[model samples]
Target chain A: METLLSPVVLFFLLGAMATLIRSDLAIPETIGKAMSLYLMAAIGLKGGVEVSQAGFTPDLVLAALAGLALSFLLPVPVFFLLRSIGRLDGTNAAAVAAHYGSVSVVTFVTGVEVLTGRGMAPAGYMVAVLALMETPAIISGLLLASRSGGQALQARGKLLHETLANGSVVLLVGSFLIGLIAGKPGFEPIAPVFEGAFRGILCLFLLDMGLIAARRLRETRSLTPVLMVLAIVFALMNGLIGVLVGAGLGLDAGSVAALGVLAGSASYIAVPAAMRLALPQADPGLYLGMSLAVTFPFNILIGIPIYAAVAEMVAR
Target chain B: MTSRVANKTRLDILVDRPLLSVVTDILHDTRVTGHTVLPALEGEGAHGPWYEDQISGSQRKVMVICVAEPDTADRVLTLLQPLLDSHGIVVMTSQVGVVRGSKFA
Candidate 1:
């Protein structure tokens, strides 16, 4: 309940409500994009600073391995389930499955804020874990597509370059490096922008996300009832898998919850772009509608707290 | 009173920004002299309404315009045929009059 009432979450709900009511409230596209960039950079830098303070640990390596494993494997079941239960084709099932296996940066950032407020702040190196988890699913999804035998495996060879060199990945990994290089004393100068103003800016970003997600819900015709139901199902199931892995690895409760958050969150940004290029025949409406409209809102609104509770249960 | 003009085929391809390269590659492969790519602000199609937004990196559309000889335009269309439905590449062709036919050809 407290998580739902947080200012950031509240702003998201407000944006969604404003859209649903057809209110004239709007954020300019450029500004919304800028806010997203800011949030990414801020999150990356903070994570880096925290890592620098803690120094490298064996646990970090364990978490990275866990993240990579989840990213590579989570899509297999999702691919089959989407084919059978959701009644989707091989191409689309692969596309949507790739998304469920990947991570959403915004959702993780939101998780950090909520978890910190609850005094369960995840370890800083989890940022690296978040970054590592972003792209492996693309490869996994492509492999699944290959099995379908329908030119669903066509890789124009641009996917690897694009996925790795994507703007979000570049900014995140780059900023994290910079943060690591410039430890606490070096970060003092910019703390005002990255730390002091973090929550306020997050509120702005979530407001824009709310509008986008809600509008996507309204405008997209690709979402069938089964796809919609499966979106939530994927979040819960994937999220629990993450929680279990994190707890089994003996990570802190906050870190375990963060893992769950990352696992549960779907990629509307990076993976969607890759899907558009790699799986051109796949419907954007189905993938985007499922990730952006259904899963995103559910995670921010309710899944965060649930994951935290589960982490506490299992990790303790 | 009017300047002399030559008949040409104008191809305007509307495709998502990411796939713009694929479309351009087809034009290049077809030997179209040159083309102009314009950022599309907003429009609606069989899928739905789309507009420019930097975040998702997918919805933004670009209009690639190439005026060329009929043969060149035909080759471009032929190359783009497979992608038209699969990639949502919208190619519009019309007979047009160009003042500098040699420039486009």
Candidate 2:
């Protein structure tokens, strides 16, 4: 309840309600973009600082491997589920599955904040884990969509390039490295913008996110109820699986929660760009609606607490 | 003094940003010498409305404009029609007059 009532989540709720009730409130495009960049940089920098203090360890390696395996393997089940139970074609199923398999940075950030608010700090190396998990599902998705042979093979090179060059990946990884090099000395100069005002900026960003999500929900006419239910189911199952893996690997409580969040959260940014190039025939309405509209809001409101609890239980 | 003008076809294609390269490549292959691509701020279509600054490039739209001779325009249009049908793209062509026809070569 406390987590739900946090200022950030409240702002998100406010934005969502305003949109649902047809209010004219909106965050300007440039402002929203600036906030997004700020948040990504702040989180990356913090991660870098943490990593600098801790240095590379065997646990970090294990976490990265777990993230990669989760990213690459999760989609196979999702693809089959969508094909058989959801009754979607290969292209649409693969597209949706790719989304489920990849991580949502916003959700990851929010989960970290929630855990931190409770006095548990996740490992800084989790940021590297986040970056590593972005692309493999795209490869799996394309292969599934291609089946025998087609344009998929020819476009693989270009799609790989596009995926790597996505702005989100560049910003997160670049900011992390900058943070690593800058170390403790560098954090002082930028503390005013990146550290002091981090939460306020996140509030404003989530407000905008809420508005956009509500709009997307309205725009989604193509999703069936079965698929809708599966959105929640996928998050639950994937999140549990991720937490189990993290606990099994002997990670701390906070890092375990972060892992759960990453596994549960679907990609709305990087995967979508890759899919646009690799699976052009797939409907954006279905994948975007499921990821942005359904899964995003769910994780924000309900999934975070449950995952945190599960993480605590496993750590205990 | 009057400026010299010659007939040409102005091809405009609105496509998702990720596919802009593929569209431009088709123009290159179809013998279009020059083209300009502009980012679209916002618009509504079959997939509903979208904005350029939505923080996701997958659904963001870009407008590709090129002036070409009729033959080149026809070839580009024929090739892109299938893509337009499959993807969320809008393609249109209008007759226009260019100052120097050779410049579009």
Candidate 3:
């Protein structure tokens, strides 16, 4: 209930409702994009500062390795399930699976905000975890596509390039490195721009996102019950895995919830673009609608609280 | 003072990177011998302005232009319509005065 009433949630709701009502409300495209970049940089710098304070630890490396493994491995099952149950073709399955294997930075950022609101914070090194998880899922999705047939092999070069050079991966990892090199003094100079302005920018971005989501939902009428069930189940299972991993790493309830949110979220920005390049035959409507319209809203509105409760139980 | 000349066909297509091959394959199937591709920086769509930094590294839009005979354009557009139905594509056909009608045809 408290989570539902948070300023972030309320703002998101306000934006969504306003957009749905066809209000003349919008954020300029460039401003929305700049906000996204600023948010990424701010989080990366904060994570770096925290990492600086904590120093190098074995747990950090282990967590990163585990995250990579999960990213690479999770998509295989998801691909098969989408193919068999959802009746999606090879391209669509691969595209959707890649999304499941990847993480959403926005969700991770929201998790951090939630934790902060509750007076609990995770180690800044988790930003590294977020960055590490971005690319492996793409590689996994590509591998799944290749295994489907020989025709996909011809596009291997393009696939590899897209996966490696994807935007989210570049910004997240690049900003993290910048934070690490700059440390505290460096972060302080830019804090006013990146940190202070983040919340206001995020509100604007969320407004744009709300409009995008509503439009997608309006266009998609064929997202059947079976797929909806699958989306919900996968989201729940994904969150559970994150909770377990966070607990094993000795994270508290709030931190565990944050990790869960990170794991459960799917990429609309990065993976969809890569899929368009790597899996042209794939139905964008199916995967894009699923990720952006279905999974994203579920995680933001409902999954966060459920994860938090689960984390509390486990911690207790 | 304008004289009627043989009309040549022009085709323009805009697509994402993944579908580039599929589009090329359509061209190949239609026996298109030559074409030019230009990169799109960014633009708005049903989803909004697809930022280059959002998805794949290339984050580019490609515009494929081909000038061919009327018969070839008709065949190519028929094949292309479905592939591009869910995706973004623009096809335009305009009459061009061919100086060397035999070679173009």
Kindly list the interface RMSD, in angstroms, of each predicted candidate in the order they appear.
Answer: 1.2, 1.7, 5.7
Per DockQ, the best of the predicted structures is: 1
Error of 3 at A89 (Å): 3.0
Backbone clash tally (model 2): 0
Per-residue lDDT of candidate 1, residues A250-313 (tens digit): 9999999999999999998899888888888888889889998999999999899999999988
Q: How well is each residue in A20-56 modelled by candidate 3, as lDDT tens digits?
A: 7888786655666777777887888788877877787
Each prediction's number of clashing residue pairs: 0, 0, 1
- Residue lDDT tens for model 2, A242-278: 9999999999999998999999999998998888888
lDDT of each: 0.90, 0.87, 0.74
| lDDT leaderboard ranking | 1, 2, 3
Quick one: best TM-score, which candidate? 1
What is the lDDT for A262 in model 1?
A: 95
Specify the poorest-scoring 10-residue window by lDDT in model 3 chain A: A149-158
DockQ of each: 0.73, 0.70, 0.23
TM values, all candidates: 0.97, 0.96, 0.82
Please give me the DockQ of candidate 3 compared with the native complex.
Answer: 0.23
lDDT, candidate 1, at A291: 90
